[model samples]
Target: FFFIMNLQQITREKHTYMLQTGDLRQELKKQEGYVEEQRESLFSRLVELEQSAADYCEQIGNFHTNCLQTVSSMKQNRESATENATKYQQTVEDLEKWLSS
Candidate 1:
Protein backbone atom coordinates (compact mmCIF):
# COMPACT_ATOMS: atom_id res chain seq x y z
CA PHE A 1 0.00 0.00 0.00
CA PHE A 2 2.83 2.43 0.85
CA PHE A 3 4.48 1.66 -2.44
CA ILE A 4 1.25 2.37 -4.29
CA MET A 5 0.86 5.68 -2.47
CA ASN A 6 4.44 6.61 -3.28
CA LEU A 7 3.87 5.86 -6.98
CA GLN A 8 0.67 7.93 -7.04
CA GLN A 9 2.43 10.88 -5.51
CA ILE A 10 5.21 10.68 -8.07
CA THR A 11 2.68 10.48 -10.91
CA ARG A 12 0.81 13.51 -9.68
CA GLU A 13 4.04 15.50 -9.44
CA LYS A 14 5.03 14.52 -12.95
CA HIS A 15 1.62 15.58 -14.28
CA THR A 16 1.89 18.98 -12.66
CA TYR A 17 5.40 19.48 -14.04
CA MET A 18 4.14 18.59 -17.52
CA LEU A 19 1.35 21.15 -17.26
CA GLN A 20 3.79 23.84 -16.21
CA THR A 21 6.10 22.98 -19.08
CA GLY A 22 3.17 23.19 -21.54
CA ASP A 23 2.25 26.61 -20.24
CA LEU A 24 5.85 27.75 -20.58
CA ARG A 25 5.94 26.48 -24.18
CA GLN A 26 2.79 28.42 -25.04
CA GLU A 27 4.19 31.57 -23.50
CA LEU A 28 7.41 31.14 -25.44
CA LYS A 29 5.50 30.80 -28.71
CA LYS A 30 3.59 34.01 -28.02
CA GLN A 31 6.83 35.90 -27.28
CA GLU A 32 8.39 34.60 -30.48
CA GLY A 33 5.41 35.79 -32.50
CA TYR A 34 5.58 39.21 -30.90
CA VAL A 35 9.27 39.50 -31.67
CA GLU A 36 8.68 38.54 -35.30
CA GLU A 37 5.93 41.12 -35.63
CA GLN A 38 8.14 43.84 -34.19
CA ARG A 39 10.98 42.92 -36.50
CA GLU A 40 8.75 43.07 -39.56
CA SER A 41 7.44 46.47 -38.55
CA LEU A 42 10.97 47.78 -38.05
CA PHE A 43 12.05 46.40 -41.41
CA SER A 44 9.13 48.07 -43.15
CA ARG A 45 9.88 51.39 -41.51
CA LEU A 46 13.51 51.17 -42.57
CA VAL A 47 12.52 50.64 -46.18
CA GLU A 48 10.27 53.69 -46.12
CA LEU A 49 12.97 55.82 -44.57
CA GLU A 50 15.47 54.72 -47.19
CA GLN A 51 13.08 55.50 -50.00
CA SER A 52 12.38 58.94 -48.58
CA ALA A 53 16.09 59.65 -48.29
CA ALA A 54 16.61 58.67 -51.91
CA ASP A 55 13.84 61.00 -53.01
CA TYR A 56 15.34 63.89 -51.09
CA CYS A 57 18.72 63.22 -52.65
CA GLU A 58 17.20 63.27 -56.12
CA GLN A 59 15.47 66.58 -55.45
CA ILE A 60 18.71 68.08 -54.19
CA GLY A 61 20.53 66.94 -57.31
CA ASN A 62 17.87 68.54 -59.51
CA PHE A 63 18.14 71.81 -57.63
CA HIS A 64 21.93 71.85 -57.98
CA THR A 65 21.69 71.15 -61.71
CA ASN A 66 19.29 74.05 -62.19
CA CYS A 67 21.62 76.39 -60.32
CA LEU A 68 24.53 75.36 -62.49
CA GLN A 69 22.53 76.05 -65.65
CA THR A 70 21.53 79.44 -64.38
CA VAL A 71 25.18 80.30 -63.65
CA SER A 72 26.23 79.22 -67.13
CA SER A 73 23.54 81.37 -68.73
CA MET A 74 24.54 84.37 -66.62
CA LYS A 75 28.15 83.97 -67.70
CA GLN A 76 27.15 83.95 -71.37
CA ASN A 77 25.09 87.09 -70.95
CA ARG A 78 28.02 88.88 -69.24
CA GLU A 79 30.34 87.98 -72.12
CA SER A 80 27.86 89.26 -74.69
CA ALA A 81 27.44 92.53 -72.81
CA THR A 82 31.21 93.02 -72.61
CA GLU A 83 31.54 92.54 -76.35
CA ASN A 84 28.78 95.09 -77.05
CA ALA A 85 30.40 97.67 -74.78
CA THR A 86 33.75 97.30 -76.52
CA LYS A 87 32.15 97.82 -79.92
CA TYR A 88 30.24 100.88 -78.70
CA GLN A 89 33.45 102.42 -77.31
CA GLN A 90 35.26 101.88 -80.62
CA THR A 91 32.38 103.47 -82.56
CA VAL A 92 32.41 106.55 -80.29
CA GLU A 93 36.19 106.98 -80.77
CA ASP A 94 35.81 106.83 -84.54
CA LEU A 95 33.01 109.45 -84.49
CA GLU A 96 35.13 111.82 -82.37
CA LYS A 97 38.13 111.42 -84.68
CA TRP A 98 36.04 112.09 -87.79
CA LEU A 99 34.47 115.20 -86.30
CA SER A 100 37.79 116.68 -85.21
CA SER A 101 39.29 116.22 -88.67
Candidate 2:
Protein backbone atom coordinates (compact mmCIF):
# COMPACT_ATOMS: atom_id res chain seq x y z
CA PHE A 1 0.00 0.00 0.00
CA PHE A 2 2.80 2.47 0.83
CA PHE A 3 4.42 1.84 -2.53
CA ILE A 4 1.16 2.53 -4.35
CA MET A 5 0.75 5.81 -2.44
CA ASN A 6 4.32 6.82 -3.30
CA LEU A 7 3.68 6.16 -7.00
CA GLN A 8 0.49 8.27 -6.96
CA GLN A 9 2.31 11.12 -5.20
CA ILE A 10 5.05 11.07 -7.77
CA THR A 11 2.54 11.16 -10.61
CA ARG A 12 0.77 14.13 -9.10
CA GLU A 13 4.08 16.04 -8.69
CA LYS A 14 4.96 15.38 -12.34
CA HIS A 15 1.60 16.65 -13.54
CA THR A 16 1.98 19.85 -11.47
CA TYR A 17 5.44 20.50 -12.83
CA MET A 18 4.21 20.08 -16.42
CA LEU A 19 1.42 22.58 -15.88
CA GLN A 20 3.83 25.11 -14.36
CA THR A 21 6.18 24.66 -17.31
CA GLY A 22 3.37 25.28 -19.79
CA ASP A 23 2.37 28.47 -17.98
CA LEU A 24 5.94 29.71 -18.01
CA ARG A 25 6.20 29.04 -21.75
CA GLN A 26 3.02 31.02 -22.43
CA GLU A 27 4.36 33.95 -20.39
CA LEU A 28 7.64 33.89 -22.28
CA LYS A 29 5.79 33.94 -25.62
CA LYS A 30 3.85 37.01 -24.52
CA GLN A 31 7.08 38.80 -23.44
CA GLU A 32 8.71 38.01 -26.77
CA GLY A 33 5.76 39.45 -28.69
CA TYR A 34 5.90 42.65 -26.62
CA VAL A 35 9.60 43.00 -27.30
CA GLU A 36 9.07 42.54 -31.04
CA GLU A 37 6.39 45.24 -31.09
CA GLN A 38 8.66 47.67 -29.24
CA ARG A 39 11.48 46.99 -31.66
CA GLU A 40 9.26 47.69 -34.69
CA SER A 41 8.02 50.93 -33.15
CA LEU A 42 11.56 52.10 -32.46
CA PHE A 43 12.61 51.24 -36.00
CA SER A 44 9.77 53.28 -37.43
CA ARG A 45 10.70 56.24 -35.27
CA LEU A 46 14.30 55.98 -36.34
CA VAL A 47 13.29 56.09 -40.00
CA GLU A 48 11.22 59.19 -39.43
CA LEU A 49 14.09 60.87 -37.64
CA GLU A 50 16.43 60.06 -40.47
CA GLN A 51 14.07 61.60 -43.00
CA SER A 52 13.73 64.75 -40.93
CA ALA A 53 17.48 65.07 -40.73
CA ALA A 54 17.76 64.76 -44.49
CA ASP A 55 15.16 67.45 -44.99
CA TYR A 56 16.99 69.80 -42.65
CA CYS A 57 20.25 69.22 -44.46
CA GLU A 58 18.65 70.01 -47.81
CA GLN A 59 17.17 73.21 -46.46
CA ILE A 60 20.49 74.28 -45.03
CA GLY A 61 22.19 73.62 -48.34
CA ASN A 62 19.62 75.73 -50.16
CA PHE A 63 20.04 78.55 -47.65
CA HIS A 64 23.80 78.48 -48.08
CA THR A 65 23.47 78.73 -51.87
CA ASN A 66 21.10 81.69 -51.55
CA CYS A 67 23.51 83.45 -49.18
CA LEU A 68 26.38 82.97 -51.61
CA GLN A 69 24.35 84.44 -54.45
CA THR A 70 23.44 87.47 -52.34
CA VAL A 71 27.08 88.08 -51.44
CA SER A 72 28.07 87.86 -55.09
CA SER A 73 25.38 90.40 -56.01
CA MET A 74 26.54 92.79 -53.30
CA LYS A 75 30.14 92.52 -54.47
CA GLN A 76 29.15 93.28 -58.05
CA ASN A 77 27.18 96.33 -56.94
CA ARG A 78 30.15 97.61 -54.94
CA GLU A 79 32.47 97.25 -57.93
CA SER A 80 30.03 99.14 -60.15
CA ALA A 81 29.78 101.96 -57.64
CA THR A 82 33.56 102.29 -57.44
CA GLU A 83 33.85 102.47 -61.21
CA ASN A 84 31.20 105.17 -61.37
CA ALA A 85 32.99 107.23 -58.69
CA THR A 86 36.29 107.02 -60.55
CA LYS A 87 34.68 108.19 -63.78
CA TYR A 88 32.99 111.09 -61.97
CA GLN A 89 36.36 112.17 -60.47
CA GLN A 90 38.04 112.02 -63.87
CA THR A 91 35.26 114.13 -65.42
CA VAL A 92 35.67 116.77 -62.67
CA GLU A 93 39.45 116.94 -63.18
CA ASP A 94 39.08 117.37 -66.97
CA LEU A 95 36.52 120.19 -66.48
CA GLU A 96 38.85 122.00 -64.03
CA LYS A 97 41.78 121.86 -66.50
CA TRP A 98 39.64 123.27 -69.30
CA LEU A 99 38.43 126.10 -67.05
CA SER A 100 41.98 126.93 -65.96
CA SER A 101 43.20 127.03 -69.57
Candidate 3:
Protein backbone atom coordinates (compact mmCIF):
# COMPACT_ATOMS: atom_id res chain seq x y z
CA PHE A 1 0.00 0.00 0.00
CA PHE A 2 2.83 2.46 0.77
CA PHE A 3 4.54 1.72 -2.55
CA ILE A 4 1.36 2.42 -4.42
CA MET A 5 0.93 5.75 -2.64
CA ASN A 6 4.47 6.70 -3.49
CA LEU A 7 3.93 5.95 -7.18
CA GLN A 8 0.73 8.01 -7.24
CA GLN A 9 2.52 10.95 -5.63
CA ILE A 10 5.28 10.79 -8.20
CA THR A 11 2.78 10.71 -11.03
CA ARG A 12 0.92 13.75 -9.68
CA GLU A 13 4.21 15.72 -9.33
CA LYS A 14 5.16 14.85 -12.89
CA HIS A 15 1.83 16.10 -14.21
CA THR A 16 2.13 19.39 -12.35
CA TYR A 17 5.63 19.94 -13.64
CA MET A 18 4.50 19.33 -17.22
CA LEU A 19 1.69 21.86 -16.88
CA GLN A 20 4.07 24.49 -15.51
CA THR A 21 6.60 23.83 -18.28
CA GLY A 22 3.90 24.16 -20.92
CA ASP A 23 2.84 27.53 -19.51
CA LEU A 24 6.42 28.71 -19.46
CA ARG A 25 6.88 27.70 -23.09
CA GLN A 26 3.80 29.62 -24.14
CA GLU A 27 5.02 32.75 -22.31
CA LEU A 28 8.44 32.42 -23.93
CA LYS A 29 6.89 32.29 -27.38
CA LYS A 30 4.88 35.44 -26.70
CA GLN A 31 7.99 37.28 -25.52
CA GLU A 32 9.91 36.23 -28.63
CA GLY A 33 7.13 37.51 -30.88
CA TYR A 34 7.06 40.84 -29.03
CA VAL A 35 10.81 41.22 -29.41
CA GLU A 36 10.59 40.55 -33.13
CA GLU A 37 7.85 43.15 -33.53
CA GLN A 38 9.89 45.77 -31.70
CA ARG A 39 12.95 45.06 -33.81
CA GLU A 40 11.00 45.51 -37.04
CA SER A 41 9.57 48.80 -35.83
CA LEU A 42 13.02 50.04 -34.94
CA PHE A 43 14.34 49.04 -38.34
CA SER A 44 11.56 50.88 -40.10
CA ARG A 45 12.22 54.01 -38.08
CA LEU A 46 15.90 53.82 -38.87
CA VAL A 47 15.17 53.65 -42.58
CA GLU A 48 12.96 56.71 -42.38
CA LEU A 49 15.61 58.65 -40.49
CA GLU A 50 18.20 57.77 -43.10
CA GLN A 51 15.96 58.95 -45.90
CA SER A 52 15.31 62.21 -44.11
CA ALA A 53 19.01 62.78 -43.64
CA ALA A 54 19.65 62.17 -47.31
CA ASP A 55 17.01 64.67 -48.31
CA TYR A 56 18.46 67.26 -45.95
CA CYS A 57 21.91 66.78 -47.40
CA GLU A 58 20.60 67.18 -50.94
CA GLN A 59 18.85 70.42 -50.04
CA ILE A 60 22.02 71.76 -48.48
CA GLY A 61 24.01 70.93 -51.60
CA ASN A 62 21.48 72.72 -53.78
CA PHE A 63 21.59 75.78 -51.55
CA HIS A 64 25.35 75.89 -51.67
CA THR A 65 25.33 75.71 -55.46
CA ASN A 66 22.87 78.57 -55.65
CA CYS A 67 24.95 80.70 -53.32
CA LEU A 68 28.06 80.11 -55.45
CA GLN A 69 26.20 81.18 -58.58
CA THR A 70 24.95 84.33 -56.89
CA VAL A 71 28.45 85.23 -55.74
CA SER A 72 29.80 84.81 -59.28
CA SER A 73 27.06 87.00 -60.69
CA MET A 74 27.79 89.72 -58.13
CA LYS A 75 31.49 89.65 -58.94
CA GLN A 76 30.79 90.10 -62.66
CA ASN A 77 28.45 93.02 -62.01
CA ARG A 78 31.07 94.72 -59.83
CA GLU A 79 33.73 94.42 -62.55
CA SER A 80 31.38 95.88 -65.16
CA ALA A 81 30.51 98.81 -62.91
CA THR A 82 34.18 99.58 -62.27
CA GLU A 83 34.96 99.59 -65.99
CA ASN A 84 32.10 101.98 -66.71
CA ALA A 85 33.23 104.35 -63.98
CA THR A 86 36.78 104.47 -65.41
CA LYS A 87 35.46 105.29 -68.86
CA TYR A 88 33.26 108.11 -67.52
CA GLN A 89 36.25 109.61 -65.64
CA GLN A 90 38.35 109.58 -68.80
CA THR A 91 35.63 111.35 -70.79
CA VAL A 92 35.26 114.02 -68.13
CA GLU A 93 39.03 114.72 -68.10
CA ASP A 94 39.17 114.95 -71.89
CA LEU A 95 36.33 117.50 -71.96
CA GLU A 96 38.01 119.65 -69.25
CA LYS A 97 41.33 119.70 -71.16
CA TRP A 98 39.58 120.73 -74.39
CA LEU A 99 37.68 123.53 -72.63
CA SER A 100 40.82 124.89 -70.91
CA SER A 101 42.83 124.82 -74.14
Q: For residues 1-101, could you state the per-residue lDDT of candidate 1 as single tens digits? A: 99999999999999999999999999999999999999999999999999999999999999999999999999999999999999999999999999999
| Total backbone clashes of candidate 1, pairs 3 or more residues apart or in separate chains | 0
Highest-scoring model, TM-score: 3
Task: Look at candidate 3 and tell me the lDDT of residue 79.
Answer: 100
> Candidate 3 clashing pairs?
none
TM-score of each: 0.72, 0.77, 0.78
Off by over 4 Å in 1: 1-5, 91-101
Candidate 2: C-alpha lDDT: 0.99
lDDT of each: 1.00, 0.99, 0.99
lDDT of 1 at 47: 100
Summed backbone clashes in each candidate are: 0, 0, 0
In model 1, residue pairs whose N, Cα or C atoms come closer than 3 Å (at least 3 residues apart or on different chains), thus clashing, are none
lDDT for model 1, please: 1.00
C-alpha positional error of residue 75 in candidate 3 after TM-score superposition, expressed in Å: 1.5
How do the candidates rank by TM-score, highest first? 3, 2, 1
